[model samples]
Target: MAFNFFKKKDKDTSKKQDRYKELTVKEVIKATKDAIVIEFEKPDWEFTYTAGQFITLITDIEGESVRRAYSLCTSPLVDEYPAVSVKRVENGKMSNFLNDNTKAGDTFKVLEPMGKFTTEVDAEKKRHLIMFAGGSGITPMMGISKSILHAENDSIISLIYANRNLESVIFKKELDDLQDKFEGRMHIIHVLDDAPLNWQGESGLLNEEMLKKIFDRIPSWGHENTQYLMCGPEGMMKNVEQMLESLSIPKDNVYKESFVQGTIDKAQKETTEGSGQDYEVTVLFDDEEHVFTVPADKSILETALDKDIDLPFSCQSGLCTACRGKLLSGTMHLDEDEGLSDSEREEGYVLTCVGHPTSPGVKIQIG
Candidate 1:
């Protein structure tokens, strides 16, 4: 299953008049050797987003419509312009395209921000936020960190960031400046895989021993006042989770965000136990109902897109819940349901990106 990113939150989008907007690129700042931060000019209408939400960028690449979601690294509470940091991934079409060709004055269609990797901010609350980030996973954490530090004066943040090397770390200078400005409230520990000759900080794999040493250097708040957040590569996150479990931290206190989809089980997608035949599915969205026949081999979102039914979606690998909808009737089988919470699953919520109709009279309501 894909790593579940955040807790599900209720959001109604069907009533909104404008679902997508054309945002002009205001500036592009080179954040690292292989990463660039794209800042967009605020639209005339209200475009508010929480700290950890992601925006879907739509553009035509090689004559085909390509859409990719990038988390907003800028904090709505502190930053002047809304921006997203894009780190180039090897063989990643969208990331490479944006870094190589995107410039100021260019315009692209962007979907409104949507995500659940966020928490409510309370100025009076004094708590601790422990974050573990690696590689590009630091994007969402950057916004969350900035928002917490600016909004909650008494809340403290302890970030354990891991990277390939010193030069590969994103937001190095920005993090240092925040640490300096926040002083005691914000602390950062950097761990590098390949350290320089005279490196003073921790260097090597973030194993159990390394984590113990790092934890000793940071302040520890009791379970009642502490929360944990993590975003990073799959292996790194798995290690972190194991370490946290060994420490006897409650599972309820930990949350994570994942952009990469997990390995898919082909057998699960081949057929559902009950319904192996094609069936008609109904999708209600934007005050319109679409009725279409779905092939057994195609996913709901894929079939809908092939029929020119413009549906809201990003991260089609089932990691992002952008195509989430309520299953009004009938049964559906999901190739992956990691994006959903236990409560959401019990409430009949489904992700169209990985859903397949397993029974007739299927109706889904999308917001």
Candidate 2:
């Protein structure tokens, strides 16, 4: 069986079968001019989640169903209600619709929380977490910071967040409150692209020089006791990765969450090069076997959804591993494999959303 990380150990097995839930919006608070935080009422059934997981919100707009995934900003170990912060993006249908129309009494259909960018909390462990966030990417980091601080007495967090300007900083007051409450345990450094005249914080692109200065200010926990995390625009993350490499930071100690699919170009390969023909793929999920023909033009998950065969999926761009399945037989070509770690790829784990059958008799098993 596929490993089920989202399942509650004490809950009945029947409840684990549910893939979606209807959650009533308890409140909506304006986090910034372009962002709003939506809080959901606790359901009668048990709804549990890890700190860094995200929920896919589904709604109808202009007679068309739309879905978008947003990371939960409320921690299961700290907060009373689960919340997600949505920031408006250019030409983002779901984001704009929610920001403009969603209210406290509205109810939404949401997929259960799912993600891999999480850490297991241990009270006995003493560690330091260094996080870099840009714009709305701070959502998951907020939950993670709260969880770590509340659960581990000796663990500390250092956050370096960047935004367009002071007015656009999401969760400003909330972050200040956390800093004040945790005092020496939590440290935050804010960087802005456009700063006011009297601004005392950083105001520039996060270049190598800026990172060096920032590193000098933060606590110097040895690499063995420190873990680095980043979530933000592709450009910023690339820059940070380059700087970390220059600083001799090991790649294994750094992790990142991508909200958008990367645009880095890869060498082109023929879609049917291996198979030399259209292929029929078999997917075993939910105790049923689904057989379908997948054309070179469409992904496996896209074909399944077209046939009303609902296999699990979110962020079809392949940044989220919600449609991951273990390949039991045959070969597949992936347009993007950023969601899967190197070990997972070696273990035959494939993401159906960006996967195309590249050989005959392809078989996959999904939970």
Candidate 3:
């Protein structure tokens, strides 16, 4: 037997995850009636971020500790306070609090930035970047589009943004500024679900025909120079994928990231594909241990939440490593792994947001 001693950098325990630091709110801008942009002063700690990474905000709300992740709408390439846009979600605890209660001069702790929905941009490469953003999914795309436009001189960005109507569009004014700043280099196409009279832009949901028309704008797709970045509803993302398959485009050309609904299943919410039997696991996080009875179909994070365990988590879709832990001893299955690197798996690290223990007595160290 051969042992691979080449340790992965990402799995190295020495690299401590950045702790949450107090960030002073500089200002708050109401992007729309339902969405607001909060800007924060950068802390003293060394913080550097890519285009699409997210910041995890921890707040003490109504006698309960709540944490939620929001993508940075500010670009790292641009010197500004780290900013994130919050759109009001129906019955969303954190979203409502952020939208209705948060204000300038307030202080909150934000975890270090982490996310994998990013790409490397080369200034010399002349490529066409196409992005699809729906609702709040436009957050990260804003940073990415700005970064690409500012850093990558030769690359062009085409953004197809979807909204319920003109009033519901997030970052409407900022996007318009980008259009003016980039002129011919950046092109934006607004796709509204509810359009006003004499509406000329696209109005229907994303389908094969709509996707074909969107791709038709670019002279060369399914080739080496075009890269697709999609973030939005799962149905729309899949529609684009299906269209790509039909066009025989290489899978590598398209990149996508989606938001998962919640860290755990809520009351009466049924999930699919599990043994339906209760499985036991012990989780250790931040020097505290808690035992949870996780249904085979539910993820460990979900189980923790149901049991009222406060676990540090962001982006329940496994795209953020906040819920990652070491699998000390367990037989678990991981369904989504884009956030984790290949080397991290070899080092026994698993994203608990998407990990399920198959049997009882699984031990996980989440600290």
- Regions more than 4 Å wrong, model 1: 1-17, 271-275
TM-score of each: 0.92, 0.93, 0.81
Residue-level lDDT tens digits of model 3 in 193-304: 8899999988988777898998787656337888888888777777878988898877778788777543345332333334576777888765556676777678888878
Give candidate 2's root-mean-square deviation (CA, Å): 5.1
RMSD of each: 6.0, 5.1, 6.6
**Model 1 whole-model lDDT (C-alpha atoms):** 0.88
Alpha-carbon local distance difference test for all models: 0.88, 0.88, 0.80
By lDDT, rank the candidates, best first.
1, 2, 3
Model 3 residue 336 CA deviation in Å: 6.0
Candidate 1 per-residue C-alpha lDDT over 73-147 given as tens digits, one digit per residue, 9 for 90 to 100: 989999989999999999988999999999999998888898888878889989999999999899999999999
* lDDT of each residue in 77-186, candidate 2, tens digit only: 99999999999999999999999999988998888899988999999999999999999999999999999999999999999999999999999998999999999999
TM-score-wise, the better of 1 and 3 is: 1
